[model samples]
Target: MNQVIHTLLNHRSIRKFTDRKLSQEQIHTIVKSAQQASTSSNVMAYSIIGVTDQNLKNELYKVSGHTHVKNNAHMLLFCGDLHRINRLANTEDNQQTIDNNLESTEQLIVATIDAALAAQNAAIAAESMGLGICYIGSLRNDIKRVNELLELPGHVIPLFGLVIGYPDHNPEIKPRLPIDSIYHENKYKPFAEQEQFIEAYDNEMRSYYGNRSSNTKLDTWTDQMIRKFSTPTRMDVTPFVKSKNLNKR
Candidate 1:
């Protein structure tokens, strides 16, 4: 395989890490690489907070299932920061004309796409440099708590957290559906092979998670998804986000 394809095909989500810390120079390089990714309408609407403080990390760790924070070397809180535009566009003698409400259907996607692009870019850069990274969307487990802990202003909200470090263990590559199931020729179709693909993937995850079982075996991936999607453990996020004035309409 070509080296680039090789790199992509080998991708795995790494959660455990060695105790080694990422150097300040490495952090800067990764962030610079992320900034270089294309942004929507030239509006760089995202921001990142590097939390080096153990106290803050602990607080956020609780919000993020307290798993990745305790296991990873660095945790970065990426955000959809529409506040910068509003703050900068406002003047002492004038009003702010910027649309800061992410609640709006139209504006929300721009910030989300911008943030996701930046985060993915960071992930690719880290992987190429022999660093392992995992995204912790569970940070949204308590959005208000996260906002308060980060002192995030209105119009700025946490999208997720990225944990990076030297991987301590190698995990198997999580299988993906066939290319035809995902890729479109010219127009999008409701790909017909989803059920078959998902069933095969179930067997894959069953083997993936079976290694740690001592009693009942782990559910197949699809069964696990049904259970996960049926549960409501993180129910506080919607109200919390609305309280932060995000209103994600």
Candidate 2:
């Protein structure tokens, strides 16, 4: 495989980071890479907040329910932001027109997709530069608090945060589902004897967990999913989104 493809395939989430700081040139290149990602209707409805303030990072550490944020050299918060579009539209449009755009579910989805695509691009750039990254999705665990901390305006939602720094330790690559199980031919296939595939995957995961260097556990992938999804999570997301004047439709 080529160098880019090799980097993509070897991607791993790095939590433990060293004290090495990222240079301004590196940050500029990463942001430029993110801006090059495709966007729905070319709206580019996303904003990245690069945080280095110690106090702000401490607050985010609590909000994310993860301590890694405190150690990372930098944290980038990718937000699904329609506020910029609304502000631009307000220059030549009515309040009703702006509200109509911000309240639709389609617009919300578009902005979210734009932000996620941009984030992935940034991740690839970071990894290629030999920097480590871990996506902090738990930022949504307390969405309102994050908004308050960041002083975000309406029509903007914090989707997730990315922690970037030099790696303190190398981690094993996690396993994924079989190709046939995930990739369907032309037509969509549903529930086509996945028991065997799942069982095999579970065994592979069990072995992986047992052999990993740190936080080793004797559990299968299925067990982890059950523990994760069996309990309702981020239930406040819908209400919080509505409070931000998004997804009301």
Candidate 3:
């Protein structure tokens, strides 16, 4: 494979990071790379908050309960933003129509997708620059607090945080599902046809869990997933999202 594919394959979720901070040049490059990601109809419905202030990072850390949020050299909160487009489009000529469109469920999905696409681009760019990165999805644990702390206006929401810095610890890359199990030829593959694949993957994951360098445990992928789904998480997210006047359709 080429260098880019090699980089992608070796990706790891880096939790511990060194004290070195990213230079302004590096940060600029990463953000620029994110902006280059494809957007829906060129709307580009996303914005990034680069938090360098120690105090602010600390607050975010409390909300996320993830040490990487505060300890990283830099943290970026990627937001789904329809507010910019809403404000720009809601002139005397089109206020009513624009307001209706922005509040639709379709628009919410569009903004979220755009933000995710951009964040992935940023992550790859950071990795390419020899930096480590971790995605902080726990930021959604207290979604309202995040919005309040960031002072995000309506039609805007913080989706997740990306922590980037030089690597302090190198962990083994987690294995993913087999291609044939997920990829379909023309029609969707039913569960009956994929049982063997799942069984094999569970065995592989059981071995991985038992032998990993840190926090080793005896567990299969299916069991872990079952435990995860059994407990409802971030239950307040739906109400919070509606409070922000998003996804209200």
Residue 155, candidate 3: Cα error in Å is 0.3
Sorted on TM-score, best first, the list reads 3, 2, 1
TM-score of 1: 0.87
Q: What does candidate 3's lDDT look like per residue over 16-108, in tens digits? A: 999998999999999999999999999999999999889989999999888999999899999999988878874777977777788789988
Between candidates 2 and 3, which one is better according to TM-score? 3
Q: What total of clashing residue pairs does each candidate reach?
A: 0, 0, 0
Evaluate model 2: give its TM-score: 0.96
Alpha carbon lDDT of each predicted model: 0.78, 0.91, 0.92
Q: In candidate 3, list every pair of residues with a backbone clash.
A: none
**How many times do residue backbones clash in model 3?**
0
lDDT of 2 by residue, 68-120 (tens): 88889888999999998877755445777888878999999999999999999
Worst 10 residues of 1 by lDDT: 92-101
Global CA lDDT of candidate 3, please?
0.92
Residue 204's lDDT within candidate 1 is 72
* Clashes, model 1: 0
Best candidate, TM-score? 3
